[model samples]
Every structure is written in structure tokens, then in C-alpha cells.
Target: MDTILIVNPKGGSGKTTLVTNLAGYLARQGEMVNLIDTDKQKSSIAWLKHRSPHLPTIFSTHTHNFANFSVKPSWSIIDTPAGLNEEILKKLLKKVDLVIVPIQPSFFDFQATQSFLEILNTKKPIRKGQTSVALVGMRVHPRTITAQQLEDFLKRQGFPIFTYIHDAQIYLQMASKGFTLFDLSPAKAKTHIEQWQPITEWIQNAHKI
Candidate 1:
């Protein structure tokens, strides 16, 4: 099984949104997917409970049993709380195959990711092939300068940013109505469908490495 950790050190960075949709998309693709909600807020778990039972999800609060859980599902996606300390984050990192840090295209979000990187870097040498980090730009406007600047800044900092999710009313609308991306309108569904390709490709490649 492959484990993907979705994390960010700041709230409103689209962590639950990313985790839920990504899990839904992957589960639809026929992979047995298990979602572990480590966030104290339990937002992802609540969302899953409210949504259709088509997707398989498991809500977990204990980080200790996380790594050893019999992840029968081929993919295990973990949604962790924002701003977790180095000690806890390091322990979680050791359990996952890849770490995905979702950040908004804003100075505050960028600054927040710095602390997360610091925690990850502290375990760098020992973490060589054990894990990889990917920066996801969420709720970004198409032509916004902030988006462009964030893209450039992340690149300059040598962070591996793989994809961008545009600011779409469909996401919020669906969430408010207790629906997943699959339940969105056709146009919105198409957008997510297109964006998911590269994300899944990168995930697959990370497992191979």
C-alpha cells in the first residue's frame, strides 16, 4: 500500500478539500483508498460521513496506530492538522510514502510552509527515499500576480510544486451541500478530472521511486 500525507501548517490552506477530492478521485479510479483524518477538527471525517457511501474512508485520531494499521486499501491518504510540531510531524512523515503540502497563493501561506519545510529538512538525510514533498497551489486565480510570484518563489526555493487548482465556486458550493467533486456540475467535474491526471501520475511515480 502507498500512503500519502496531506499537510500544511496553516488553516484555510485547502487541506481538507484537497484530501477529500483526491481520495474520491483515486477511489473512483478503482484503487482501494483509505482516508485517515488526523486533524483534530475532523472536518474530513464529517465530510465523508455526510457524503455518499461510494467512497471508502476511515477516520483516525491516533497517530501512533496510523503506520501499523492494516492498510488493506492500496492507497492510504492522511489528513493532518495544520501547524503540527516537528516531533509529531516527523513521526507522521516516517509513516507515509509521500507528503503533500497544500498552500494558497499568498504570502501568509508561503511563510507558513517554511516552518513545515524546516521540520522536514531536519530529518532530511535519514528521510532520503522514505518520503518526498509536493507543494500544491490551491484556490489560485488565473492571472493573479500573487499566484505567479508564489510559483516563482517556490521554484527558486527548490520546492517540488506539481499542480495548481484554480479558485472555483463549484468547490465551495459542493462542499456546502455535502458533495464531492464527482457530484459537481459537468463543467466543474471536467476541470477536476483534468487536474487529477498529473496529480495521480506524480503519486504513482513517487511510489515507484
Candidate 2:
């Protein structure tokens, strides 16, 4: 199974949003997926509970059984908590196949995200490129100055910005309705679904490298 950890030491960085949507995408494609919520808010857990029966299922796992050696799925998406420290990060990395860090266009998000990258940089595996990692820009407008700054920031870190999700109400609306962009007809969600193509494709190909 391929494991992905969605992390950002700062809250409201859309970690849960990435987790739920990515899990939904994999499941809709006929892959058995698991969603593990390590956040105290249990937002991912709640999202799965609210998920519609018609949509592809996202099996939820508890914290206690998170490191299970036997149970496996095609993909395992983990939603991490804010203010995660280096020690916990190292522990989590030991089990994950890839890491995704989300950033918003703000100082708070930038500061913490940069520091988080520093932590990852120190890891032997990260330095060796043994761990596949990517950066994501969340709720960003393509034409804004903030977007430019975020781009520069990510570029400086030497990490690829897989894809960006624009600031739109559809994400929130889908969350409330127990749905995701993948749950909607392509004719209606083509734009949003297109934004995720690169990220999903990257994950699918990571196993080969």
C-alpha cells in the first residue's frame, strides 16, 4: 500500500481538505483507500461519517491501530495536527511513502511551512530523496500578489508545487453535503477535478521511483 501524510504545523492550512479529497479521488477510481485522522478535531473522521453511501467508501482507522502491520489499502491518507514537532514528524515519516505540505497565502502559514521544510531537510531520507514529497498551494488566487509570493517561497524551498486549489465555496459546500469534486459529474466539476490531476498522477507514479 502507498501511504501519504498531509501535514502543516499550522492549522487551517487545508490539511483536512487535501486528505478528504485525495482519499475520495482514489476510492472513486476503484482503489481501496483508508483515511486516518490524527487531528484532535477529528475533521477527517467526521467527513467520512458524513460521506454519502453512493460515493466510494473511505475506510476510517483509529489512532491506536494506525501503525497496523497487516491491514493495507491501495492508498492511506493521513491528516496530521497543527504544531507538529520534529520528533513526531520523524516518527510519522518512518511509516509514510510520501509527504504533502499545504500552504495558504499568509505570513503565519508561510513562516510555519518554511520551518517545517527545514525539519524535513534535516532528515537523512529527505536529503537522499528516499522520501517523495510535494508542496500544495491551497485557496490561492492565481493572479494575486500573494500567489506570486507563495510561488517564490515554494521555489526557494526547492520543492515542486504539484497543483493549486483556488479559493472557492464549492469545497465547503461539498464538505457539508458529504461529497467531493470527484462525487460530482465531470461535466459540472471538470475545472476543480482538473486541478487535482497532477497531484493524483504524481502519487500514482511515485511507487515506480
C-alpha TM-score for every candidate: 0.87, 0.94
Clashing pairs in 2: none
Model 1 Cα lDDT, one tens digit per residue, 1-209: 88888888798898889888878777666767888887778887777767765544433333445446555577888888876667677677677778888878888778877766666766863357457778888898978898898788678655578788888887877775547675566775887767656777888777676
Q: Please, what are the lDDT tens digits per residue for candidate 2 over residues 1-209? A: 89899999988999999999998888988989988887778888887888878888889875733345333877888888888777777877878889999999888889988888988988876788878789999999989999998888888988888988899989989887668889898898999888889998999898556
Identify the leading candidate in terms of TM-score. 2
**Model 1's TM-score against the true structure:** 0.87
**lDDT on C-alpha atoms for all candidate structures:** 0.74, 0.85
- Candidate RMSDs in order: 2.6, 1.6
Instruction: Please give the lDDT score at residue 24 for candidate 2.
Output: 87
Query: Scored by Cα lDDT, where does model 1 land?
Result: 0.74
At residue 68, candidate 1 shows an lDDT of 60
